[model samples]
Target: MPKLTKRTIDATEPQVVEFFIWDESIPGFGVRVMPSGRKSFVVQYRAGRRPRRMSLGPSTVLTCDQARTRC
Candidate 1:
């Protein structure tokens, strides 16, 4: 997968099913693209033995760099 840069995000068109594009550089830092074409920043991490997902905000509200450093 490509790095989550502004260009990458813009180039990634939403698909029929929602999917996540994780940043290889920052483990869980990534974005979620809904089937509706909505995009949001997301951070995934383990809560105890189980994993969890958190939505930071819409992609319009946070930049890739901001999302990367947030989690």
Candidate 2:
């Protein structure tokens, strides 16, 4: 995994299958690239032993810094 950054996020290319690129610096913070070419920022964590994932927003609408702040 690479550290999440504006440049890296902007440069990411969508894959045939949806995949996630995790942030090396922020645990559980990552970007999901879908086959439809949409990118979304997400944060994963555990709440009372139940794992959960939340989408912050599309990468086009939110910068890496903003998503990191939300995380």
Clash number for candidate 2: 0
Which structure among the candidates has the greatest lDDT?
2
List model 2 lDDT by residue over 1-71, tens digit each. Answer: 77888888788888789999999998999999999889999999999999999999999999888888998
Every model: Cα RMSD to truth: 0.9, 1.1
How would you encode candidate 1's per-residue C-alpha lDDT over 1-71 as one tens digit per residue?
Answer: 76788888878898999999988878888889999889999999999999999998889888987877778
C-alpha lDDT values of all predictions = 0.88, 0.91
Off by over 4 Å in 2: none
Residue 11 displacement in candidate 2 (angstroms): 1.9
Question: Candidate 1 regions off by >4 Å?
Answer: none
What TM-score, over all chains together, does every model reach? Answer: 0.92, 0.89
As a whole number from 0 to 100, the lDDT of residue 29 in candidate 1 is 86
